[model samples]
Target: MRIFVCIKQVPDTETKIKLMPDGSGIDEGGVKWIMNPYDEFAVEEALKLKQTAGDATVTVISVGPKKRVADALRTAMAMGADDGIVIDCENSLDSFTTAKALAAAIKKEPACDFVFSGKLAIDDNAGSVSQYLAEFLEIPHVTVVSGFEASSGKYVVTREVEGGTKEIFELTGPAVVAANKGLNTPRYASLPGIMKAKKKPLSELNLSDLGLSSSDAKVSFTNFELPPEKPPVKFIDGDPAAQAKELVRLLKDEAKVL
Candidate 1:
């Protein structure tokens, strides 16, 4: 069995975010990018499956630009993926176009029995690419996957819904699942794995090579802008009973919650 895990490059969670002078998007300059968190879970899950399904091979694919996307690929390899493919998109893709690009890559590669991706890219937070890619590839797609089990050429997926509801889906091979957080514990890249990762092959392909065009990406962003700062918070301090009374009064009168 062969599995394709799609990963994305995103801003590090701790990286101080600044808007690019206008409100459209993030300021890329001086920003450090990391793997999309949910993608890590997807990678972890793929690695787990490969371990269970002996003779299975796992491939990590990312659409991005870098002097080298090696760093991201290295991370995946260190986690046990066999090979990597990089689509040189860098900062020029939107959700719709990216999904198409990945679908093209998946088609070219062939032998992909399953595809896994994070539920959303952290920086953009547009959680539509995985579903779109499934659509583009003409395969079943499901999101927010909390648990999954694969066998008999089919997969049973568990997910959470609004208001604490639960949903389950059964999809066959070649389907795509957008993994949710907590799917698995992501392993840290060890010294041995990191060293081996450096030796792993990382192939870079251009947009034309993937048959994806920047023009197909419709959204236009002039620049980024910071959201308005919130006013300072006020606290009411007193004994427990006094605080409870104050809270009740505030909720009823001050906040007009009556």
Candidate 2:
């Protein structure tokens, strides 16, 4: 069996982000990049599935600038993926165009038995790519998956929903599964695995190679700016009863929540 895991290179959550002077986008300088944390779960689940199947191969795929995305793929290889494909593209593509590019890239390789990805990228947090990919590939997809098992040539997945309930699904054919956190513990890259990853095959392709272009983007971003500075806190100086009245007055007149 062949499994494909999709990942994204994103700014580390702790990294301080700066906007471009013209508000076109964030400044890339001095930014620390890493694989999306949720994608790590997807990769770990793929590796676990590979271990269970014993004859399976896990291929990691990403769409982004060559150097950064390639680095993310190498990290996945260090975690046990067999090979990788990097679709060289601008970092700002919308989710639709991104999914289209991924589907095209997957079609260029041998057909895969399953596709795995994070529920969403940390940067955009759009939480839409895997569904779009399944649509483009004409396959079923389940997102926010927390449990996964395989039996009888089918996959049974469990996902949490609103109201703290869980929904289970069984997919009998090739399908896409977007992993959420708590699915598996991601392993850190070891010294030997890191050394071996340096030799793993990584293919790079361009948007044109995938029959896509910048015009295919369905959404555009603009007017990027930081949120306004918060106002200072105000104190109510009064006894308990008076404080309650003042709070109610403030809420009704000043804050307008009443």
Candidate 3:
């Protein structure tokens, strides 16, 4: 069996984001990049599946600038993926275009038995790529998956839904699964694995190579800006009854919640 895991390079969660001067996008300077945390779960699940299958190969794929995204792919290799492919596109693309590029890249390789990815990327939180990718590939897909098992040539998975319940599915053919947190514990890259990852095969492709272009983007972002700063807190000074009256007055006249 062959498994493919899709990942993204994103600003570290703790990093303080700054907008570009012209409000076109976030400023990339001095930003720390890491693999999307949810994608790590996808990679870990893929590795676990490969280990169980024993004859399976896991390949990592990402779409971004080669310099940065290659690091994410290498991290996956260090975590035991066999090799990786980088779809080298420097500009940020919409979820549609990104999924289209990924599907095209997958088609250029040997037929894969399954595709895995994060439920959503942290940067945009659009949570739509996996669905778009599945549509582009003409395969079944389950998103926000928190459980998985395989038997009788079928995949049994559970996805979290509204009301704290989980929906179960059994897929008998190739499909895409977007992993959520708590599915598995992602392993850290050991020193030896990191060193060995330097030698693993890493291939690159461009948008044109995938029969896509910037014009394919269905959405465009502009006028990026931070949220307005919150106003300072005000204190109501008096005894308990007076305070209550003042609070009610403030809510009704100033805050307007009541």
Model 1 regions more than 4 Å off? 22-24, 221-223
**Each candidate: what lDDT?**
0.84, 0.93, 0.93
TM-score for all models, in order of appearance: 0.93, 0.92, 0.92
lDDT of 3 by residue, 163-211 (tens): 9898999999889999999898999999999999999999999999999
The global Cα lDDT (0 to 1) of model 3 is: 0.93
Put down candidate 1 lDDT per residue, 1-258, tens digits, no spaces. Answer: 989999988879989987755567776788887888999999998988887777888999888785545578779999878889888865748888888888888888758888899998887798999999999989898889889897877788988889978799888677898999867888887889888887887777878997768889866666466667888876889999999999999999888988
lDDT string for model 2 (1-258, tens) is 999999999999999999999999899999999999999999999999888888999999999899788999999999989999999977658899999999999988877889999999999889999999999999999999999998757899999899979999999988999999988889999999999999999988999998999788998888999999988889998899999999999999999997
Ranked candidates (lDDT, high to low): 3, 2, 1
Query: Which 10 consecutive positions of candidate 3 have the poorest summed lDDT?
Result: 148-157
Q: Residue 18's C-alpha lDDT in candidate 1?
A: 77
Clashes of 2: 0
lDDT of 1: 0.84
Q: Give the TM-score of candidate 1.
A: 0.93
